[model samples]
Structures are given as structure tokens and as C-alpha cells.
Target: MDSDWRMWSRRDLLAEGMGRRGIQHAVEDGWLVRARRDRYLASTAPAELIRAVRVGGRLTCLALLRLLDVFVLTGGGLHVHMPPNASRMRSPSDRATPLAGRGSREVVLHWVPLLRSLGADDPRVHLVDALAHAVCCQPARHAVATLDNALHRGLVGEPEIAEVFAALPSKYRIVRALLDRRAESGTESLMRLMVRAAGATYDLQVVIDGVGRVDLLVDGWLVIECDSEEFHSSWHQQLKDRRRDLALAQRGYVTWRVTAAQIMYQPEEVAAGLRGLLAARRGGR
Candidate 1:
């Protein structure tokens, strides 16, 4: 096998005789990609890491939310869960923090000592990771999305959610409540929060006269759609959305569509633009 691909299947390398210098050489030679100081990936790591760094390393929180297909606004830095004792072993570059868990660095690591009590099969790990990151990052919508995704993926159940809620810091009660609400996807939830923040009053999943169930409605005058590129990037879907917009417009309902990028990165701009448009409509301008 290629040296770059050696880390995945080599249990022996993870054992004795493995030193930092050997790992560093492997990284320098492109034989391995360093995910953390002691942890290496023999293959290309998840592209989300690069994206996360670009967005200020906030991708882990949002990525985990996305993995759960929950609705959330992406926010700052990769939040990692690391065991308290593991901090001494990590390099400064790892950017790890102490949390309640004992996890090896696969992605971001948060060191929390409490993770030891949970059963190995429990999905609370993912929930705690997402929630802790969300609380730290202030991506309340994204936190909700992660929780929704966890529920949808069967990675977490109702009881698990309760456990997570109980474990959360007292300040994160708002995030916990947001997570309690059912959401279809992280993108949608983020958009909803954005719209609400913009002072747009509308019913979610409201049925219009002919537009079917729109994702969001604004004062019975506008329809807002949140598009996730992963699912809506296809030409057919784009065409369909355009058709739907045109049909909605013909029926006297204004349509505004927001993409995941806009919702995640430029939320204020999106909200401001929508608010301006709504104001103009109200003024009959």
C-alpha cells in the first residue's frame, strides 16, 4: 500500500516504537496527513477541515450539524472534545480544550473528563460535541440542527437528548430549547432564525394558495426558501425552484431564496435584504 495510506490499517504503528519524529517524517514526505500530533490519516482527510479553517475553524460544529442534516447557522472554530488528562499530550497546534470525554483526536478534540461514565455505544458523544461547540461558538441555530440531525440519524434518541440537556452548562438552556424543536435540516433552521431575527413574521411550512407548502412565509406576502447545495445543486432542482418562484410571483406572492452559503456566512446581509424588500412591499414601492 502507498505510505500515505498506511495509517488506516496499521495497528502496529499505533503501538510501541512509534515516535513523533517518525510521524513528522511521514507527514513531510506526504506519506501521511497529520490530523493531530499523534494521530495521522493515511488518506486524504475530510475536506470539511479545510473549509472549517477557512471559516475560522468553525466547521466542526457546523459540519457535525450537517452530518446530522440539522438546520443551523454555521459559526466560528472547530470545537473539539478532549479528555482533561489528554491536554498535556496535545501540541499547541491541536487547539484542544478540556471537556468531559476521553477521545482520541480524529478531528477536533475537546477534553472533558465526564465522558468516561457513558456506555461505549451511547450516541451522547456526538450530541455533547455538537452542543458544547454550539455553546462556545454561539451558533444556537446550528446547535439545534445538530440535535435534529442526531435524532434523524438514529445517533441519538429522546432519552439521549434529555441526558445531553442535563449535562449542558446552565447558560446553554436557550440552545437546548431550540434543539427541542423539530427541524427538517440545519440550513432551514438557520434560515428560520435569520428571518425571525430580521423581524419577519411568518408561519413555517405554511400552505399557500398554489405554491404548496413553502418553507417560510412572511406576512402572507412573501415566500422564503432555504436551499442546501448538497441536495439542491442539481440542474433539475434549480429549474424547479425557479419555476416555483415564477409561479408564486404570478400568484402575487414575492419569493426570496437563500442558499446555505448565504445563511451560514452572510446571514445579516440576507436578513437585511429581505427586510428591505418586505418594507418596500409594505410601502407599495
Candidate 2:
């Protein structure tokens, strides 16, 4: 048997050298199970391997994203992007069938020339590949995470990120904002954006009467503290945060402490609460 036939099926082997009669004999002898037209798998093959062989290599972006653990919203179909000028051949076993209706469209296909240099085994390269195709992303935090991952994994450096930022179009304000505030902590940067978006005019890292440097001071009335898991992970840091909040409260400032999760996942709720506090202060004044 040819070396390539090891990865091929009995029918492929027959096509290469063995006749159709040999393939039929092999099937009858329980050496292979016919999975599809011109396709066969050994009976001892693992279920996953068999399934992969049957479906071909048509895994879409969504499935791959889930496997990569990237945050993705529901409802969008799978998208697979290839490199420009590369062969756009669909595997024979790809089973990602199209739906029938408005939302029943098949997975999307994108061609990016940069993908040619990427290695499939490297996850950081895969994430960069995915980000290259992302048109719009909400809450700037996601981009921050991707950037942080790229940096932390050594896939890209600070200079590279800066270069990409400089090349972006002027209309991409959100992207620019994210690039400008690319802090070491994604949660901190996200919270800062959320507060700014909510129109909470504040001084960052402001000094107060009693408290030392605080995260934000809104009109000298509200002190907003963004607690990230990385910085405030230990009990000592948690106690320090509480003490700072109490000291600020004693100094006539209403301290509002928000966690990373609140900023990343529940921005609207936090914004509403801040708005209520600001309105109450305005009414009292």
C-alpha cells in the first residue's frame, strides 16, 4: 500500500492499485466499514476519529472559538476564513449543512492573506487569525483581552500593537479608545471605559481628604473604585480596599466599589446605580 493510503480509505486504496473486487472483499472480510461513497474506516477506529473522517474538515469558526474559550455571543453561524490565493477546497466529510430560511445561511467564508503564515497548532496564532476577521466587537474589553493574550503569550509585542493601532482608520473610535487604554489589566481598562461612557466626569487616581489615591473621583462627590481580581486577589488587598472605601465615605464622598465582573458583564446595571447616586446628590444639593 502507498504511504498516503494509510490516511486514505479502502476505496482510495482500490482506486490507487487494488481493484473494486479487492475493496469488496476487504469489506466482506470485516476489514472496513463503508461510511460514504468512496470512503471507509476500520472497525477499530475511535468514534471521534470516525466522525471526523465522516464529516471532513468543515469545523466552523464558532465551534473553533468555543474550543478556544473565547467569548462569543450566540445566534451567528460559523465562519471560517482562509488565506488569500489558497485553495478553497471543501473536505468531502464536511457536514456543516446550510439551514433553510433567513438565518439558515451556511457558515461564512473569509479570505485573509495573513493567514498563510499561521500555524494551526499555535493557539495565539489562531486567536490573531480570528481577530483579523472581527468587524465589530462590543465593550472594548474583548479587544483588550485579545491584546493582553497576544502580549502575554508572546505572539505580539507592544510595538506591534501600537503599529496596528496607528494603521487603523480614524472612524474606528472604539478601537482607538481601546488602543489608547491598553492597560495591563483588561478589567481595569473596561471599568474605566464604562465609567467614561456613563458620563461620570471624574479624576483618575485622585487624592482625597482622608483616603490616599483612589481610582476615580466624580465631581468630588462620588469615589469610584474598580476592583480587579489580579490586584485585589489576596485578603490583605481586599481589606485595604474596604479601608480605603470607608475612609473616603467618612470624608464626605459616596464611594462606589465595582468588581471586574460587574464592569465586564453588567455594565448597564452598574451605570444605572451610579446614575441614581449622582441624581440623588444633585437633588440634595
Candidate 3:
């Protein structure tokens, strides 16, 4: 009858005198349902976490990031963080379908030995640890985008970021170097990373004479505007964008816009476009 009874292991319930028959009655009465092998949850409990625990792991990486309501480029997996060398077949007989999708859904196992240090009572990874693991696992720009959002939401602070960097190995710290709280979305973060990687100079969130504040100003002339779908959806917003482009163009600033899809899904195309624009500028064309 307790609200905390949302989830209970069979052994724990038996120890509490629920017994096999009582448990069966609870299941039959629609008060409790089996989540996985020995685990049961109230009918109303959130199904988000069931698959991760069923696989003998805690939610981490992209899955945890999404659950925290942070912006992510593209991730639709059941990412589970397990102890190193842990068997995939913890309870092979009882496999719960991962919650994300049918064919595209798969349990991504991240083997981290450090998980053993956490208490056995909880399977949820701490936010700092999860972020650190995410940085190590994700692509450089995606990882920085996660960090930026975390900082933006005050879900993490400078001290927390410092701790994450300290815990990471030297090589993995490159991801941290890309972290910037100024980035408002994954699209902007990816654009900056791509520009920097291509050896081009850029200033982020730069305010020019015409455009109030563009996402990036590249090589003192090219204005890069990064748009996420949600912001650019309305006609009013499109009109404002066109006006901003016209205003910037009058000031001799060429506006080059990149959408979230282009930044995330078409990196080569984005790079090619940037290359052409830069070449044109250099050639005075």
C-alpha cells in the first residue's frame, strides 16, 4: 500500500511476508506487475527505467541525458552502464523489450568498472558520473552540447565540470575543451566544433551592426546562423530571419544558415558549403 512500493524485488517482498501467493494476488489485482526477472513495479510506475535495470545496468550516456531533459543531437537507444566484464545474460530468460522502438532499439552496454564503487541499493548513475561517461562515449561535439545544456539548466556547475574533467583520462579531456555554455543548442555547438576543426577562426554569439547577435561570426565577415527546428518553425520567425539576413548583407556580412539537421546529419555538406564560402571570401569573389 506504500507509494514507495512502486518497485520491489521478489526476495525483498518475500522477506516482508508478502509471500508468493500474496505477490501473485497483487499482480492479478493489477496493483503490481512484473518488470523483469525478480523485479516488480506498481502498475503506475514509470516504464522508462525498467529495461536498463532488467539488463543489470544503470541508465547512462544518451539515455540518461535525455531523461534529464537535456538537448541531444540524435540518440534513441537504451544505453545501459554495466560493470566491466559483467555478463550480458544476467537473467537471460526474462528479456524486457527496450522502450525506445522496435528494430532501431537496442541495449547499448557501457562497461565501467567504477560502477562497483556505488552502493548496490541504487542503479541510477550520479549526474556527474553520467556526464563523464557520456563525454567519453559520445562524439566530441555531442558531448560538449550535453555539457553546455547541463550548464545552461544549472544541472551542473563549474566545480562539477572540473570534477568530471579530473576523473577523465588525458585523451578524453579533448571533449571537455569543446564545452561552451554560450551554445544554446546542439546545432550551434556542432557548427562551432566543425568550424574550429576545419582551421577557420570564429567568434560565437557575436553582436554585429545589423544582426543583433548571430550564432557565430567567421573570419570577421561571414555570419553563421544555426537554427534548431523548434525555433524556426513559425512564419513570423522565418520573416524575422530573412530580415536579419538582409540587414546583415547590407552591412557586408554574408549570412550562412545551418539547420539542426544539416549540423547533425549532413556534416560533409556543411563543411563543403563552408569551404566554398571561405574560398570565395579569400579570393575576393
Candidate 4:
């Protein structure tokens, strides 16, 4: 099997008993490619990594988080991390020419300093550094969800979170209080934020009499199920959603099944619907 894509610098290759000529031969054979001036990466590495290097920086921000299997609020383009003093960067798709002022839509360049040193030869940014960058890159609510996702996945510990905060400005310190490790998914985390933003109090991962465990329970009568965006979503949803809703309904609990899209894009409408429902419940009494 191929190695774990550990960076192979020129010196590393030489130390591994491979001659300069052998290295060139491997490159010619398409077995390896020079990722940077003196660094090498296996051709079998993920295309995104290769492209990030081609774009003149390390894969970072949401791109790195996604590669680490951590959750991100949204997706688009290649997020490349350039040095704070980096200049004359190349395009994400075309490295031959220098990128214009700022960057292109296809490549979002984060010209920020790293909190932790991601080695010079590494093609990806460090996790804590990426999370910090993500917090700056995304909106406040989405940033909290991203952090919650990192915690939910157990990707970082206290030290790592501390490092991430050290990298961010003071304004983001408030977000530290919003994290919820109990959040099973980014969608669920975002849903919880929506509840808080709507001035509603809720219990997380609460078990009702017959509804099993729920994402969020508001006012002891509402169950909000955050249907995260996942592959086979419809199929997985059909497995238990209606059954859970029916069971909750029978027990006098109202199940509000919130789709990922609605929570992510149309949050105001969801909050309004929530308020309307809650007010109606109060009025009925």
C-alpha cells in the first residue's frame, strides 16, 4: 500500500535511500509529483490538496476542516491559506499567472498568520489554525456551528481549543460560550443557535416519554428534529422521522422537523414559524 502521504521533502527522499535520479524517474512515471520547490507529495493524494499547493498556499479554512471530516456550515471554492506577507499569489486553477488583487471566486485566499506552525512542507493547515481561520471566514452563527462540529467530532481538545482562541481576535471570545458538544451535527448545532437567537429556551438531546431522544426540546412541548444534510438523506429520514413524529404527537409533543437547508438559508422564516407556533400554543391556554 502507498504511504500515508506523509510529506517527503527532498532531504527525506534522499535519506530514504532514493537518489535524485530515482526521484526524477518516479516523477516521470507519475508515481510522485513535486508539490513545492523541494517538497514532494504522492500523486495518489487527494486532488484538493494538490490544487491548494498549486494555488500557492496550504489547504486551509473550511477545505482543511472538511478534509479532517469536521463539519462546516457551507461549501464553495478552494480555501487556500497564504502567508501574512505572501505576495503575487497564483490562481487556484491556473498557477502559471499571478492572481489579481485580493483573489478569484474559485479560490478564497486567507492571508492570515498561523497560530500553530504548520510545517513548511505540509500541504494542509493545522486543525486549530484552520478552525480559527474558519471562525473569521464564516458568519458568527455558522462559526459557532463549525466549532461545535469540531468538538462534536472530538477532533480537538481543550489545548487545541485554547490555541484556536489565541489565534482569533477578542470579539470571537463570546462564541466560546456557544459551543455544544452534544450537537450531533452542524445542522443540529445551528438549530440550537436558532433557538437561542429566537429568545427561546430549550433542552438538548432530551428524551420524551415515547419520542426517544430529540435534538432540541422547547417549552417542554415542542420537539425540533434537525435533519442534517447527509447522503441518502431521504432514505435515512424515512426510516424513523414519521414514526418519531407520530409517537411524539400521540404523547402531546409537537415535532418540528427542520431541514438543513431551511435552518442554514431561511433561518428567519424558521424563527418566525417557531414564534408563531409558540404564541399559538400560549394563546390556546
Candidate 5:
């Protein structure tokens, strides 16, 4: 029952008064499943964490951050952290077999050690380590977004942020200048980068006299709101958003709505679109 409520070591079960026979009986009774040698999982264990254990690595970096509800710009596969010399990897899908080849792309693996290990039964990388690994996993802007997301959610403060940078090489320190706690969402962090790359200036989380607070204001006229499908999909929410847009428009502010999907799945397209509109604005047409 202890140890993050899911993964457990054999010693953990033994400490909980489960002897050898008792452990076997629990497995047979479907109360527990053997995750690996000396490792076990409760029936209620999360499939993702189980996958990390089965793959012979800890869930980490983007994979773990996304699981913790932090901002991750890209998504594709399960991310894992293992020692540089670890072996006997199994397929994440079926725990029964070993991986067929050198490595599977489906399981993104990080052999580099960013931080000290956590408890044996803790199937996740430490949050600070995960953040450092994420810095290595993503491009510059994306990495900054992830850091901002962590800060905005109060998951880590400036000291922890300093620890993350300390784990990285010196060149990465440049990204520290871009980290801003005010970014309300990962999307806003990304949108801010896109706006800058478009050669436009913006004020983040700015408020106008007539309109309420906005995600970002570009050149004092354009307001960009990073919308997510889950929150902005409702009829009522859409009406509210439309009204907000109109209100800004009436006050000589142009509002651009960017969806989460469009930003993550279509970055180049979004950047191109932003450039065109920003150019039009600069031309005063």
C-alpha cells in the first residue's frame, strides 16, 4: 500500500508481512502482477507507469512531465530513463518478452544520467531530474515552455529551476533568460516564442482598458489567446470567446485564437501564418 501506491519491490512486500508464499498467493489471486524480477505492481497500477517499469527504465522527461499535467510541446512515445549500461529491456506493450532489437523507437530512451535516483519502487524520475532531461529532450523554445509550465503550476520555484540548469551544460544557460512564470499555459509559452520569431514584439498576459486580461498582446493591437480543445469546446465558452474577440476588435485590438493542436502538431504552419498577419499589420493595411 505504500511506495507511491502502485509499484513495489519484493522487499517492500516482505516488509509489509507478505512472505514468499504470500506473495505468490497474492499474484495468483490477481491482487498483484509481477512487473519484473524483484518488482511488482498492484492491480490498480497505471498502465503508463507499468510500461516504464516493463521497458526497464523510469518514466521521465516529456513523458513524465505530461503525466504530471505539465506542459509538453511534442508527443509521440513513452519516454524512459535508464542507466548507461542497463540491459534486459522488455517491450512496453507485453511484459512477457524482451525487446527484439537494439532499441525500439516507440520507447524513447535516455541513457544519460541527469540526477540521482529515487526510491526503487518509485517508477518516475525525480521532478528536477525530469526537468533537466526535458531540457535535453526538446528544442530551445519548447524547453523554455516546459520550464514556464512547471513554474506557473507552482511545481518548482527558482531554486529548483537553478538546480535544473546546474544539471545541464553551460550553453543551455542561455534559455534561462526566456523562462517566464507568467505564461499561463504551455501554449502561451509557445505562442510567445512564435510571436518573437515572427519579428513582432508582444506583452504577455496584458490587459486592455476595455477588455479583460489576455494571453499576449502584439504591437499593442493583436491579442493572442492560446485555446485548448478541452476547455474552449463548449457552446457557452465559444460564445464567450467570440464576444471577447469582438470586444477587443471594437477597441482596435485584433484577436487571434490558436488551438493546442495547431501549435504542437502544426508549428511551421502556425509560424508562417503569424508572419503573414504580422507583416500585414506592420504595413498598416
Candidate 6:
């Protein structure tokens, strides 16, 4: 499949001199799927590319980060970049499907010009540009999560990010500076960002004897572990976590576990609890 043509509009085919009937023929022959009103996807197109086109925008921000295998807090909905002058723009509410109820595929639009540098092989915004857009458009912690994963994957480096930061608005520059590649998941990155923003000192992925690597070590003795469903869904995994916590306790580290729910739905409460713990630790010391 030509990567660029894997997901495209009817106009793209018409521009190539293939009339409307040609597109219809391809659909009938099972070569294409009508992804949305005007968007079409090759039968073999990647899900992300299909989603990008279906949303009437290029895949970008967290969407591109997902394709790069970077850690992004999932379920924030589809991220797409639509050119300001693009035709047939509609609000997300108007685009919802009744059969799907609220719809799992809610689209988040980033209004911007299409980057000219995007290669023919990609239906998404170029990585650097997407990262820049992500940093500017998302909350600082969420943006940092994407940056951390990009760095971890070796998809981007500090220098490229620095260059991107140079062009970003002043508010997002601080998030770029705070990006730490050591974060293994979006949850950990976000929690760490919140802790720091709340004026506490912490270290990420800190190694302790007999405890493997803990997620975040704050104020010297408190260990914070960000637990996703992947870590805690099984009884066996819960037993292992308990054992790890016991080991850390024996070694003079206090282990605290945070869940995806607390991170997503109760961030302020999470911050408050972290602050209380840090304050208590300081008082004890």
C-alpha cells in the first residue's frame, strides 16, 4: 500500500484523474472502506491512519505519539490537526453517531496549518511538529508524558525538542524543560509533573536494594508507584506488589500506590494526598 494513499479523501482520488465511479468500484471490490462521510481507507490501512482521515484532519499530537509507540494517557480521545481553512468543518457534537451512544471515537481537533514538511509516507503530522503542537495544546503534565515516551523510544532527542521549544509559545517552554525520558508510562510522568508543580522535590525510577525500581522517590523516603490496570488486575500481581512494598518498607522507604482513576478523575485529590504525605515525612524527619 502506498502509505500516503492508505487513508485519503475522494478529492485525492479525483485529483489523480480517477473519477467518482473509480472510487466506487474500488469500494465494491473490497479495496477500500468508506471510513467517514468523505474519507476512505484502504482495506489494509492501519487503524490510526483510518481514524486520522475519518476525523477530517491529519493524525497529530497524542494520536501520532500512539503510532510512535510512545506512552500517552489513553482514552483522551482521538487527536487530529485540521487546517484552519479546511472545508466542511463541523463541531464534535454534530459528528456523534447515535448507534454508538456517546461514541468511543470522539475527535479532538487542533486548528493549525498542515506542515509542509510531512513526508509522502505519513498521513500524520511530522513528529517534531506534532510534539510541538502537543506541548502547546495539551496540559503540561500530559504533554510531558508524550515527550518522555518520545525520548525513551529514541524517536526524538533533547536537542530537537529544544529546537521545537524555541518556536513554541513561552507557556509551554517550561514543560519542554521538565521532560524526563526515564518515565515508563504516562501515569508516572503526569504524577511526577504534578508533584514538582506542587513544589516538592522528587526522583523518578529510583533504584532501591531488593525492590527493583520504584516509580518516584519523593523527599528522600517516600516511594510513589503509579499503578495501571496492567499492573494490578490479577491476584498474583497484587501479591507481588505487596511483597515489593514490604521489601521497600524494610529498607526504610514508604511505598504508596496511585491508580489510573485517581490520576484521571481526581488529580487535585492526588496532589493533596502527596502534599500531606510529604509534609508528614518532613515533620517526622
TM-score of each: 0.62, 0.53, 0.80, 0.88, 0.90, 0.77
Say which prediction, candidate 1 or candidate 4, comes out ahead on TM-score.
4
**Which of the two, 2 or 5, has more lDDT?**
5
Order of all candidates by TM-score, from best down to worst?
5, 4, 3, 6, 1, 2
Predict model 5's lDDT versus the native: 0.85
Model 5 misplacement above 4 A:
1-6, 94-96
Once superposed on the true structure, which residue ranges of model 2 sit more than 4 Å away at CA? Answer: 1-80, 85-109, 115-158, 165-170, 182-184, 203-213, 228-240
lDDT of 1: 0.58
Per-residue lDDT tens digits for candidate 6, residues 1-285, read 464345566788789787999999989998887766766768787676666665556778776777667766645567777766655543333334322322245766777554446643356787887888777657777788888878877888878788678777787767877888998877788898878877888998888877798899987888999998976989999999999999998989888999977986789999999888877877885
Best by TM-score: 5
| lDDT of the candidates, in the order given | 0.58, 0.53, 0.75, 0.80, 0.85, 0.75
| Superposed Cα deviation of residue 24, candidate 4 (Å) | 2.2
The predicted structure with the larger TM-score, 2 or 4, is 4
- Per-residue CA lDDT of model 1 for 247-277, tens digit only, reads 8989988888888788778878887888798
User: Compared with the true structure, what per-residue lDDT tens digits does model 3 show for residues 146-239?
Assistant: 8998987788899999988887889877877778888777678888888887788998898887569999999898899988778997999999
Residue 45, candidate 2: alpha-carbon lDDT: 46
TM-score of model 6 (CA atoms): 0.77
Give the total clashing residue pairs for model 3: 0
lDDT of 2 at 144: 54
Model 3 ranges off by over 4 Å: 1-7, 10-26, 29-31, 42-46, 83-105, 114-123
Q: Write the residue-wise lDDT of candidate 2 on 1-285 in tens digits.
A: 222122355545766786888778867997765544445666654333333233332222343444444433333444544344533233323434322221123445544344324333111224444554442333345565555544544656666665445444555446644543334345545556666676767666676766787767787688777787878889999898889878877778787878877866787898788778877887995
Alpha-carbon shift of residue 162 in model 4 (angstroms): 2.6
lDDT of 3: 0.75
Q: Is candidate 1 or candidate 6 better by lDDT?
A: 6
